[model samples]
Target: MKGRTVVLDHIQGREAAALMVDGILEDFLIASDAPPIGTIYRARADRPVKGQGGMFLTTPDGPAFLRQVKGLAPGVQLLVQVTGFAEPGKALPVTNRILFKSRYAIVTPDAPGLNISRSIRDEDERDRLLEIAHDQMQGCDYGLILRSCCHGADDADIAEDVSAMRAQAEQVMLDPGTEPETLCDGDAPHVLAWRDWTDPAEVATAAGSFETHGVLDALDVASGIVEPLPAGASLFIQPTRALVAVDVNTGSDTSLAAGTKANFACAKALPRALRVRGLGGQITLDLAPMPKKDRKGFESALRSAFKTDLDETILAGWTPLGHFELQRKRGRVPLAEVLK
Candidate 1:
């Protein structure tokens, strides 16, 4: 099993929280004030502009835009989920597709039917999960999407999680009179990190603040301290707005064989670093040149390493200059902006 640990640090004198996994800084977010992503909000359609195909909404957090409105008129109240966070001079994006996330799965109250996770490639396991979901969904109007964590879970465990999510969805659906502009907050970033990246049962909390828990040291390592790898190797991670570029550098004293070994090691470690840094979107890896025949083996190893990531990641093949390109879905806020 891959050993994982989570650390939540309340940075002194800052209005943000830092999350570390396995002693590596992964996510940092503004505490409390950040826009709640999965929170369900009761909002009223303020005015529908005929020029635009959507309507404006007035929510408790503020105004939001509904890109599509089907016969929705002004002053119409409905339940909407926070789809995206608000940007500077921009409003949050809301959608009618409501979703409730539990420990093991996501429940879509208005979805057409049940859908299983695509990451579970094992045919037998997928079929088994589908059977379990079908059993739990009986008499329930909503649908469920089994998360990655549900891969090895028993039917009873899946049933319990689904039941809890069903209850939440039911309460929201029954409360059509919920006050407008009110929201039901979802899980926090740290909680989500722990749940998705590490086992909640294995989490150990420290009594003092982050400074006392060696979180700052981890942050320092993430910031710039490149750890020495086998054969005197190091990695330089450069993150830009377009993509993250990781450069593998070997010591001058390293032999050719040792350098190639280090390159392979770097390729294996790169994915974990990306996940811990929360560096999503496009990525490019520049490694020491190796034989053309060996490239395929290296790529295959990289693919295997990335499969462990919770978010969807796509390997876009190699470039003419021997740079490896990849794309990860922007499922969460970038660590750079979060820390800034």
Candidate 2:
């Protein structure tokens, strides 16, 4: 309970994964009815929405929207990968840049190159990985990326991972299907837990791990509107039709530094709150009433906190009305929406 713990379990018959740090829910994932990110499809190009600068395609699942498309005629078959979860009444988000990702490697069909993750800083280790890459991808044309997880792992395991990804990519690329169909399914929550959560942690995969490790309780709190912060502060995370509105409050304590402290507290806790609740898209933060001079400190705290976060986040600058904005990718369906 004092360290990182990964719990792989089920919630309401859907597979779920939870990452707990010191008995607190740090991240959460659950399956949904919509297509998960990374799903590959052989789709038929449909009508283009020129006004929106995107094209709608037909897939086995449903209609998907691909952005930045040009001159793609209707009825032409091409591969597309799901990039993100769809917003309400929108087409599934798909991209032409297909990537086959695993625990230790990623194969990119569009970007052709062999590279290693920059996090593996040791020169000798990089050379060793490069050697393995050369040997495995001798005649391959697709791009290959050795993930940071390859560091300190067994060479055989790394080799096998790269080989597996390359094979899958080749098979999908060579498929001669003329109709809309699925090429590959996305990794489920439990699989994502192992692939992305690379830090050393105690693993619990028992049937009742969620209940035994208190993930269920933490999830119940995360599903609510109020999220507790340090020094009796709180954040009201409310999702409106347009965006997620976060209102910060300095509860009880009214010290001169209360606003600054509460702002910093919200900065640190906001990522975890949004991650656990699976809330993303436009995020408007109405931070505590702090002095303008403290804005830099608040932004610094926010940047440092989200630096290690898994999902993509763009910290758009503060608004004219003192509100901070963030554009976060919708990686998964909302937890509340899923349960409902």
Candidate 3:
């Protein structure tokens, strides 16, 4: 709907730092302060619940499990936290929790009673997938985070991806690939396009095409493009973790608000401000911290902007910082990426 920037953080030695900024996206930056490790998620292993083995952690980014399976060996059980290692040409243990190294979670089942439990029309195909997973499991136990591509994927597709991975691992023995080299990747850019299409806010600005210079139309959030900004309407974009400040200069004729009018204007335009400025995430409006008489009007402006007609989304009360706060939904991308 609005023109925004999404900065994706990659992983570093101990932190993640990647930034994806999209101001219409033709001129975009997928900058990284570190490695492109993607997002980290918390997961709980559900099936074949083991008392001794490790628990699987599934995040939006990838799949990792904490192994304590050896505790089943009787006597005093030892709960082991295994951070898996990938070695070329080395056989994996049955107890090892080896997952596809990726930025997204795509787990499949390999252990007894933990295989894909869903019914399938083709028994042979299902058995084949399970067998493939079993073979990959090798020496010890393992868990798989099967990607979405696994859905309706023939045995060949899985075999190709998995085999490609295995072959790449073998190549590492002859000549190791660069750490930054692509090992496994997720869905294509068009899939991302489809996700943005479902949201209704992504293309809200551009009815025609994006300009050759890469400036998109003024955004309308969920609606459509409002009115296009006249040429020479300078836009200054400032981004913060919680809020984004967009200073719009309406040229010489524009008048600065004297009293409560400014607060009222801001309140009235907050929703559109969020949309056009791509200002989602945790947001707080400072508004110069106006006087008590103007406070009610400012709060009223915020209430009007929510568009949901519910009190659940807006925090109408004052805050400790003397600024009014608005808890809006986090957008697909961030503001800094767009603004930058």
Off by over 4 Å in 2: none
Give the C-alpha miss distance for residue 81 in model 3, angstroms: 26
| C-alpha TM-score for every candidate | 0.70, 0.98, 0.34
Over the full model, what C-alpha lDDT does candidate 2 score relative to the true structure? 0.93
lDDT of 2 by residue, 5-77 (tens): 9999998999999999999999999999988899999999999896888889999999999999888988889
Using TM-score as the measure, the top candidate is 2
lDDT of 1 by residue, 1-340 (tens): 1234455545543343455455555444434455667778889889886877888888888888898788998888899887655544666778888888877878888785888888788999999988888888898878789987788888898889888888888888678574585557867756565446534433435644466545666665665526445666888888775678888887664565655676688877876566555566788888876777888888888888777666688999989988889887654554445555
Residue 90, candidate 1: alpha-carbon lDDT: 68
User: How much lDDT does each candidate structure score?
Assistant: 0.71, 0.93, 0.38
> What is the TM-score ranking, best to worst?
2, 1, 3
Instruction: List residue ranges in candidate 3 displaced over 4 A.
Output: 1-56, 63-208, 212-237, 242-257, 289-291, 308-313, 338-340
Prediction 3 TM-score vs. true:
0.34
In candidate 3, how many Å is residue 231 off? Answer: 17
After aligning candidate 3 to the native by TM-score, how far in Å is the CA of 285 from where it should be?
1.4
